[model samples]
Target chain A: MIPATLNVYVGLSALLFAVGLLGVLLRRNTLVIYMCLELMLVASTLAFVAFSRFNGSMDGNVFVFFILTVAAAEVAAGLAIIVALFRKRLTVQVDQLDGLKH
Target chain B: MFPAIFTFLVLFTAVCAAGVIVCRNTVNAAMCLLLCLVGVAGLFVCLEAYLLAFLLLLVYAGAVVTLFLFIVMLIDVRGGAPRARNPLATVAGIIAAALVVGGLASFWVRGHLAAPAASATPALGASLKAYAYPLFTAYLLPVQVLGFLLLVAMIGVVVLSRKPDPGPKP
Candidate 1:
């Protein structure tokens, strides 16, 4: 059986992160942008797991747990903000959310 | 065999991630995100982090994606024409992402990758005992702080989503 090298996992993580970044930059809908943010979080978690596996240390896994916790909290707050914004403006488009630009 | 599986998982994840960005329908994008999360969980399992893999599948694919779908439905976003493309933002984002990937690739190719020591414990991957000791002892404070952060986030969500009281009309 061919062994999977560390570079393969790292490269995958990099690609995932780039895709997420592109989505965040290009998407106009708040919900889509939020999904992209979650994608980025997952990408980072993949990297952390890869490092932990190769280095044989549990530190990276521990950090991944903390990242998961923080990401959950962030999503809760972010979705609440999205809902509130939608309630007031009736639109989830980011460009239409420039009320604070004044 | 393992390498083949790993390669397939990586490609699956990349494709799903791209789908999340390229799909116009919000619901479809959210589903694509779910697939991407599941693919990442598979990657975790391939790395032998069983607990983390399950946690990822349960939390991200199960809970987070569901929450996204619920919000998408609640917002009632209809399928419409794609938003106007921002050429400047796309160009800038591509440049930034390329730079980041290129830098990391070069660093990896330069022989700076940390070679794993030969002392890797056999139980380090899937064993809770290996993780519990340090989590409860060395990293206890951060764990406590994490709980506190979650509590605050819960309260903030409630406060932020509350409906405004009706006032007398002029």
Candidate 2:
């Protein structure tokens, strides 16, 4: 069984990131948008791990760890905000969240 | 065997990631996100980053996705008015995503980036000690800062989500 090359991993990461980007742009639901954001973060983390494995360095792995930590915190805070917004507005649709547009 | 497994994991991750966006139900989208995170963990294992694989499964799949599910259920958000599809935004997004992927693929094809030759040194991500040695040394400051950031996030979530004080009933 041949081992996958670095390019395969990097290309896959790029594809995943692009898919997440498209989701963020196309989705109207706030929660879906948040999930897409996490998807993008995971894509970057995959790239970091792949690079760390290929380069025989700990730096990339360490960065991935930090990214994971930050992502967890971001999700916690972001979800709380989403909940608060839902309570006040009764909807999570981005199109309906135009109170601040004034 | 390894490449085959890697290919399967990559495909699975991509499919699930797309599902997260395409699924209309927020619950289903969150579930897809969970599957995508697991697929990413599998990819980490294939890369020999066992520690990260476990961490990803534990933190992301176990904690984060569950949190999303809880909030989604708690909010009990109803399906609202269908948003009109914005053709202009769709076209722009497609163009931007295509450009980024094409640029990266071109770089890969040009042989501008290559993985370093595998060495005899211990793999950093496979073991906790190996990973911690660097984390506690060169990255100590950043680690400390991350702890502070987590604390702040905790406080912020509590403050933001608490029920407002209500006036006395008439």
Candidate 3:
């Protein structure tokens, strides 16, 4: 019965979100930021699932499944792009990735 | 009994999340992210959304994070300890994190939690029906469109990663 409380779920999701945010802010490595982005995605998914549980609906679960699929395809493509950029630049620092400079 | 599982899962997730951030090595951080994903999947199961949880394991844990690991392996990541010259940033980060968590906990502890309505049982069933009906009928367009998006992204990635054309003329 207590597990059904929305506040508990939201709090945990919020904590995860904060952790991901901190990682994004504090880390200079591009790969670490990418990983933090994944963590953020997971936090959002958790929020969706928790909301679905409270609403007594399964739509959130189905949506999360689709999100997972999208995330998979995304990573495959995103990582390929990251690798390609890294090969050309030799450094994955975000600061150094400005190709539009004159 | 359930409370204990919930606490354990939350603690596990928090630890992994911290690990992902605090670890200096990018590869280790990626691995920690995988651990956090697994913990989140466990939470999905706890929420009784078995299907979502399994897909999370198969797709996110199995495929996506592994792809990340492969990319990390392919790159020549610089080694040596990360510089710790910025103590002020570190202190500010920890204080901000603590304040946010503490405030949320206080709000939750104030007993504003809502009890489920009597009709909640049927609502779950209704939601399933709602999901199924539209999933097969009215909402199929976006679903198919998402598939197309993935296909395009995949093709674009392959093209981007391919070697440049060898033709002499531009």
Kindly list the per-residue Cα lDDT of model 3 for residues A1-102, writing each as its tens digit: 345356767777878888888888777788888888888888888988888877776667667756776777777777887888887888776645668874
Q: CA lDDT, every prediction? A: 0.84, 0.86, 0.77
Report per-prediction Cα RMSD to one decimal.
2.8, 2.4, 3.6
What candidate 2 gets wrong by more than 4 Å, as runs, is A1-3, B104-112, B116-122, B167-170
What digit string (tens of lDDT, one per residue) describes model 1 on residues B70-122? 99989867534456766887788778777867876785677345545323534
Q: Evaluated with lDDT, which candidate comes out highest?
A: 2
Residue A60 displacement in candidate 2 (angstroms): 0.8
Q: Per-residue lDDT for A11-71 in model 1, tens only?
A: 7787788788878887888899999989888889988888888887889898999999999
Query: Which candidate gets the maximum DockQ versus the true structure?
Result: 2
The complex in candidate 3 yields a DockQ of 0.54
State the lDDT of candidate 3 residue by residue for B1-170, as single tens digits. Answer: 87788888888888999899999787888888889888888887777666677778888888888888888888977733445546876787788778777776787677465647423543342234555775678668768988898889889988989987788986
Q: Write model 2 residue lDDT over A1-102, tens digit each, in one string.
A: 334777777777887787788888878888889999999999999989888888878899989889999999999999999999898889988878899888
True contacts kept of 3: 0.61
Decide which is better by TM-score, 2 or 3: 2
